[model samples]
Target: MENSLLVETISCTDGSLVGIATLNRPQALNSLDLEMTRILDKALKDWSQQPEVVAVIFRGAGEKAFCAGGDLHSLYDTMIEYKGQPASANEHANRFFAEEYELDYLIHTYPKPIICWGDGIVMGGGMGLMAGCSHRVVTETSRLAMPEINIGLFPDVGGSWLLSRSPGHTGLFLALTGALIGASDAIYCGFADHALARDQWEPLLQALQSTPWARTAEDFQKVTDLIHALPSIELQTGPLESHRALIDRICQEYDLERIGVSIAALSQNEDKWLSRAGQTYMNGCPGTARLSWELLRRARHMSLADIFRLEFGVAVECAAAGNFQEGIRAVLIDKDRQPKWEPATLEETAGDWMAPYFALSIDDPSHPLATLGR
Candidate 1:
């Protein structure tokens, strides 16, 4: 199908079928904007109802990235157009996040087996897309992260749901540090299913198309066997395994204050990875770190729809508070590596300060995402 936001093609081989969706914007690392989100959502919905499409595969056009993130520059420009008035831009941001969240939810509940070939940089919104697929294929070149903290935002796009469920304290560690995970590490953290060499992708695609589509499970197995037929490639070990002891020890503290103390302890540790993670956390937005800690903890028992709703609340509040603009200024616009975060120290960030962000006024059940229901 012809799409302005992406390229879509359906290729058939033998009795099997394949549906390919490629993010077409290589210049922006396939960053998703409102139009892109709409296009993706429409395509996925259509593919779900197509009888000929036995399996779907997602990828990016360039070698550089699967998707770097949402189109924050567009968001920044919109914010500017609204003159930074929170209420003026509130509806626009609300609609965007609602649509994006819906797209993520659709991916999570897709009927057919969806295989995402996350080959390169997959952060923020990209992670949301890939994490929900049935078969998440990563390559040695894959770099996955939920680095929303760097932009003074807590990880959204169902990050609270997925990251909270990661092994041990690994989720919290990644959320706070914005640390990048290679393919093997992604698999270890439950974010990716398999790690195949980048060169093996075409062969795997061919193998997928060669099988009979009538019996999906059997055909899936055939494709798996074909992929396994290739010689096994050595995977770079993840840092998680090596730093497990320290990560568990430091990340065990659920509250932000204790977590800061634990991070301080890591700064003094012998492990280099832990020390680096500590510094990253130290340099990150204290408010966001606290919010991340709270969001994950609270989202544990919440339904997916509820999670999105809660995130919508937080997102609007963040816009109102001016952190989003500052974050965009420092990270994207200024090209400056430094962000002068408010409440610069973790010690200054109190539980009560974050409480207001989480508070949804009972009278205002009018969230743009209020229509979202399980």
Candidate 2:
């Protein structure tokens, strides 16, 4: 109920059997800032301990988006604040990524049945929160992606853990191109659990809330049946679907150079969307793309805790590097839509450039989340 937090209410419907948490920042598309993350973390913990709260529902306030992303303006500002001092930037970066990762971990390991109503633009940090929920419900409006490459950062906030588990090379395709998936395609890629029409949300919530607390499983079944009754929203079709086969084939290459070559080949294709996505990748941060490839590849066998820890290290490295600030300047601050990346080609970003991300420093301790159980 705190006014500062993005979440609005913690109301119980169905006689306190279900708690509903609504993300209230409609104007900003319900972006999750640090304060909002702390608020959500606390709320989840609070409701999880309440015996009366049989289930919890997470949804955004407006129709535009479930959650767009984290408040990167704050992140950019923090980076700028420590522009002159490496120690200051590292200190701030560690705290930021650690808190964010901890919140993601909490969602992954929450005891209660946490249902997320992912209705619209769920990207980056939003995807992090949704991926960990017990039940992820997507609408036709849902447009999901891990677009950190666009911002000169590899997808963090547990992206390394979830994306690695996606089907075949689908995760790589998403990571490299920053492609957005609709509801059915999201379900196809294992990013979302249920695909329901937007209108069915209120009715579904009512049904979930009305279920008896003692017969939680039975009540959940009733709600599922109601959801099943809703009309099906068609999967992503046309050029997006046609391009998938080519994307899966081309992006399957482990080497970043081959991946770039494959993406460049798409430029000659007749498919406009693929061509645009190809161009986007061509123009995006080569260093970030390499980091993305490495992160997802390394994360394939890592535990969630380890993946988060590894990404924390990478994020700290990004803050130290100049790409994050330059990317933000071009894409967000300047709106010029052109980033002048250092060592602009994939060939320039060799193994040496990325070695520091994997190197452990004696000065820093292991992540506070090292204690996270599998």
Candidate 3:
């Protein structure tokens, strides 16, 4: 709309248009800007209504990332302006999350198949894009994580839905520690369905064009089967295998101090991955950690619509009072690596200071996503 070309749509041989939505900002890791989200929401909404558009393919332009996440710089700036008040803040924070969550919910309930080529780093907003697709593919080099805690944000891109259902307490551990997992772990956690060798990606793309399309009852299955038919990839069992027991132990304890202390203890682990993960939790914003834990707990039984609503509420609240601004300043703007969280300790992050985040105002029953999963 702004002539920025944030998303490019390509016509497929399947007929009128088998939408291929490419995230075009490679320099920024194809991150989702407000412009990009608006473009994607418009294009996908248009394509969803057209009968000739059999399926949609989502991918990134760069070699390094499918999408690292949403453009946090924009969010940081907007939050600074809005700061969580419903009346005026709704103009930015409310609208952004509302549109974003609407798009995510659409992807989940889409009648036609959606294929997300998860090639490289996929986190935060990136995870949101891939999570709802019917066919999700991972390459040998795919690096995936929720990683919201690092920025003083919970995994809002349907993170609560995906992570809550992860095997054992692995999701909780990942949410709090911002753990990065590989292709195999993605499949193990139900994040991805198929593995395609990086070298064979070209072949997969070619096959997509040559494949026949029909709006049959089994259209979704047919698309998924096509992707699965690609050459198999050998995925190494990453950290999840070795750290399963420890993650279960750490996450089963819901108390902020207990879980935080247990994970922080891993800072001394022999394994660098575990040690870094531990250090991440040891230093992450106390409010974000507690909020993530609560969301994951509540998400275990909520519907997809409810999860979106809940995430919207938390995101707005984070923008308003949580340490997200401080986190972004230290982690991105200042590069100082020192965020002064208000309630700096996990113990202090519990109780009233964290209540408003879970409460709903704009994200209530009359919310934009009320009929999301219906």
TM-score of each predicted structure versus truth: 0.91, 0.91, 0.94
Q: lDDT (0-100) at residue 207 of candidate 1?
A: 69
Collision pairs in model 3 = none
Worst lDDT window (10 residues) for model 2?
Answer: 2-11
| Candidate 2, 8-56: lDDT as tens digits | 3343454666667777778878888777778888888887787777777
Off by over 4 Å in 3: 1-16, 83-90, 361-366
Q: Report lDDT (Cα) of residue 19, candidate 2.
A: 66
TM-score winner: 3
Q: Give the runs in model 2 whose Cα sits over 4 Å from its true position.
A: 1-14, 87-90, 215-226, 236-241, 361-365
List per-prediction Cα lDDT, in the order shown.
Answer: 0.79, 0.77, 0.83
**Number of the candidate with higher lDDT, 1 or 2:** 1
